[model samples]
Target: MGKTIAIANQKGGVGKTTTAINLAASFAVLEYKTLLIDADPQANSTTGLGFDLRNIQQSIYDCMINEGQAADVVLGTEMEYLKLLPSHIDLVGAELELINHPNRENVLKKIIAPVKDQYDFIIVDCSPSLGLITVNALTAADSVIIPVQCEFFALEGLGKLLNTIKIVQSHLNTDLEIEGILMTMYDGRLRLSNQVVNEVRQHFEDMVFNVLIHRNTRLGEAPSFGKPAILYDPDSNGSVNYLNLAREILQKNDATKITNQEKILAASDEQRDT
Candidate 1:
């Protein structure tokens, strides 16, 4: 089964979409079959991967609202192993359209079910809101990667987002957990940025990623050219940081798998002895 990670932050301008694009790209570059779902109506992830929204006939909106097959809408990106489930501007209205549906929260989960096992990782880029759309993303994800901007208001609204995650865990997806909290757009030259990073690390501790995505002009410029940082400029700071982030995620996942296997073997040994 594939691991589904929803990249979310209720606060706008927090580099949520940037992380979604680059992290997924990094996974693909590392030879992992990765799929990115542009759940946000803005479709930034789609465009960031060099896709034109106007050119796409079927999008994630169709898959969620019109019962369109996810496999049919999946588009190939520039990267060999990366794929995208493009989003449309029409997705803005899906929240109201599915408002009355009994299982609205699980709509995305159902939409992506048939194709979930085909990839090693599936990343969803959520809009900056705790609306029905974000709820759907949460319900469909096995884990969440929250990107927090390294600024003065970095901790603001974090409690509310965490509360929302708890609600989703309790009522929707019991297996969902916070994969990690990423510190993005950090500027070492700025005293406040350093303070914000320390504050966040102090609070989240092990939950915070070791890789700090420093504020770089190249990171901001890559998206406009419709390419991820890794593909746009592999030697840039933004590209290097994101690659480190990907490695950290892979190592952590490997450690988790080994730990789980050890537990299973220990149980089997006990059973045999008994």
Candidate 2:
């Protein structure tokens, strides 16, 4: 089965979508079959991967509202191992439309079920809100990546988001785990940025990712040009940071797999002795 990770942060302008696009692209570049799902109505991920919204025949909205098939709506990207389930402005109204539906929180989960196992990783780009859509994304995901911006108000709304995650864990997805807290937009030259990073690390400790995504001009410009930083400029700092981030995640997951296997073997040995 594929691991589904939602890139979520209730705070806006915190590099949430940037991480979603580039991280997914980096995974694909590393030859992992990856699927980027644009759950946000903004469709930034769709366009960031060189898709034109105006030309999109079907989107994630269709899958959620009209029960469209994910495999049919999925589009191939420039990268061979990467695919995209595009989004549209129509998704803005899906929250209201699904309000009274039976088991509404599980809708996204069902939509992706038919196609989930086909990829090595599924990355979802969630909107900057704790609304129903975000809830749905969280419910569907096996884990979430919270992107925290390195700035003065870095920890402002973090508590609320964590509280929400707790509620989801309690009531919805019990298997859900926090993938990691990613620190973004760091500027080492700014003392305030350094302080923010230190404070967050002090509080979150091992939960935060080691990679610090610096403020790179190429990263910002790539979206406008309809390409990820890696494809746009592989040598750029932004590209390097994201690639490192991807590698770190892979290593962590590999370690987790080994640990799980050891536990299983231990259980089997105990059973045999008994």
Candidate 3:
């Protein structure tokens, strides 16, 4: 089965959508069959990928609220290996609509079930909130990637987000894990940025990703052109950082797979001996 990762942060302007777009694009560039699900009502992921909101006929809103199938709504992106389940502004009201539904937390999980095995990675770009929609995304995801801005206010509300994750683990998805905390928009010239990075790393240690996404002009401009940094300017620091991040994630998962396989083999050997 493909791994489902949610790019989540309750705090806005933290580069959550930027990380989601670039990271998913990086995975695609690396030849992984990837699906980027725009779970945020803003539809930034949809537009950032070169999609026009006016042109969308059906979207993730339809899938969640109208029982629309993912296959019908999924759009092929400029990258051959990447696909997108676009979101609509209508999703703003999804939380209220789903409130009374039975097992509403699992709606997104069910929506993507049929298409899960078709890709190597499915990345959900969650809304910047701890509302029901984010809860649904968390419940559906196998893991989450938290993006923290490299600024003075970076650590603020982190505790609340962590608490929300713990609650989801206890009551919704026990298999859900935090992939890592991604540090974004770092400026080496700024002592404040350096300080924030140091403090977050000190607190989270191994849980923080090693690659820091630096502030790049191309990275910001690419969105306006409806393209990822890699497609817009492959040589830019923004593109390079995201590519490195993708490779790091791949290496980590590969190590986990090897460890799991070794455990299975060890178990089999014990069984044979017994």
Instruction: Write down the TM-score of every candidate.
Output: 0.92, 0.92, 0.92
Give the best candidate by lDDT: 3
For candidate 1, the C-alpha RMSD (Å) to the true structure equals 8.2
- Better structure of 1 and 3 per lDDT: 3
Lowest summed lDDT window (length 10), candidate 1: 255-264
Query: After superposing candidate 2, which stretches have Cα over 4 Å from the reference?
Result: 255-274
* Residue clash pairs of candidate 3: none
Off by over 4 Å in 1: 255-274
Instruction: Give Cα-based local distance difference scores for all models.
Output: 0.92, 0.92, 0.93
Q: In candidate 2, residue 220 scores what lDDT?
A: 98
Whole-model lDDT, candidate 2? 0.92
RMSD of 3: 8.3
lDDT of 2 at 6: 98
